[model samples]
Target: MLTDTASLQTVLDVCGVFVFGLSGGLVAVRRGLDLFGVLVLAWVAGLGGGTIRDLFLGITPPVAVSDWRLLAAAVVAGGAVFLLHGVWEDDDARPAGGRRHVTRAVRLLDAAGLALFAVSGALVALSRDAGPLAATLIGGITAIGGGLLRDVLARQVPEVLQRELYALPALAGAALVVLLDRVDLLSPLTAWLAVALVFVIRVVAVALDLNAPRALRSTPTER
Candidate 1:
């Protein structure tokens, strides 16, 4: 069981990084950025969140900096996109069509990545003997921080700010993990169950095209 949990954590971490890196690389490609720029964005999107989480938890060296898995994920993501550049070109890659579809796919992948990172971060925090509140906060931040930085660097609004359900799903997942931990029911199975709940909610919300409350959207003139 312990081994399984550890393996799952590693997988989730790598998967989260991979998805985010892909999204970042895709964004660079959409902007017609150079290969170096794509790699830079991939690295930033993969590592930014865990870097912040580790800093907050005072984990020296940060998993992102210390672990080769993250670096590998970023490299794979950037390389994959760079290699696929020709395919995108051959497809005509209409910005409004191909780019939009790619962006939507990225958003969906991001939601899954968000769930994975939040659950992993909470588990790590709890393992380190942190309180539930701190664990939850760390988890939420871990999930959102990377994408937030990615958006900022790309000169776009962060998804969590513009989209109502993005960060909320992560927070819900983290909270569920903490709750289950308190009840001593939070094994890897339960942790994944929490992730599933978050992922489902997020997917449904996106499919329905949910938005932040009316009060949340800016006025058209503000645009």
Candidate 2:
């Protein structure tokens, strides 16, 4: 039987996969991709992070590949988007707020995926007896890797590399999970709290259009 932590981690992982898949599907729709392209993007965005994480941890044939449910979730998410995108895209039939609604929905899905993946990744690392630093790093990677792959496949700049607080929030959440675990305070409640922290931070960053500081550049000398 799975322990409470393991069970919660599994739930988080599956939820993350679904949300990320939805995000990928939305992106595919925005990019005007075909049905096959939509499915491919969803699959990669849903499973890419977990696959990379498993490989990094030496778990051959990652759970994303070995598990059928995760794959189904991706396919379903993609198909749903492909079928329903027309509803949102019908400008003459769409409500005045339709475009704003779509944007908000996509942001929310991305935030949820990032938060859940961060927590799930940390929990998986902890289960593997990885150190806190490694756990934190893996968690952040797991959160961002899918989006990175999705953006690349869609021929856009990866959000994590952009001047957004995306990766930082994920890393912070993962670090928090590691810290709580180290102190024997890592419970389902704490894990969810960490996820919420990440979500809130990311949403706020997006709403505020926040960016990390860039290096100073010297002013050009007058000719």
TM-scores for all candidates: the values are 0.91, 0.90
- Clashes (backbone N, CA, C under 3 Å), per candidate, total 0, 0
Error of 2 at 75 (Å): 1.1
After aligning candidate 1 to the native by TM-score, how far in Å is the CA of 119 from where it should be? 0.5
The model with the greatest TM-score is: 1
Give me the runs in candidate 2 sitting further than 4 Å from their true place: 91-104, 218-223
Overall local distance difference test of candidate 2 = 0.88
TM-score of 1: 0.91
Error of 2 at 71 (Å): 0.9
The lDDT for every candidate, in the order shown, is: 0.83, 0.88
Give per-residue CA lDDT, model 2, range 1-223, as digits (tens).
1249767977898889999999899888777799998999989999899988899898888999898888988899889989988866785355546667666777788899999999999889888988989999999999999989998989887888777699999999999999998788888988999999999999999989898887689464445
Worst 10 residues of 1 by lDDT: 214-223
lDDT of 1 by residue, 1-223 (tens): 1336667778878988898888888878877889999998888887888888888878899888789988899889988988986687577446577867777877887788788889988877777788989999999999998888888998887888875578888988999988987877877678788888888988898989888776657575635
Model 1 score (lDDT): 0.83
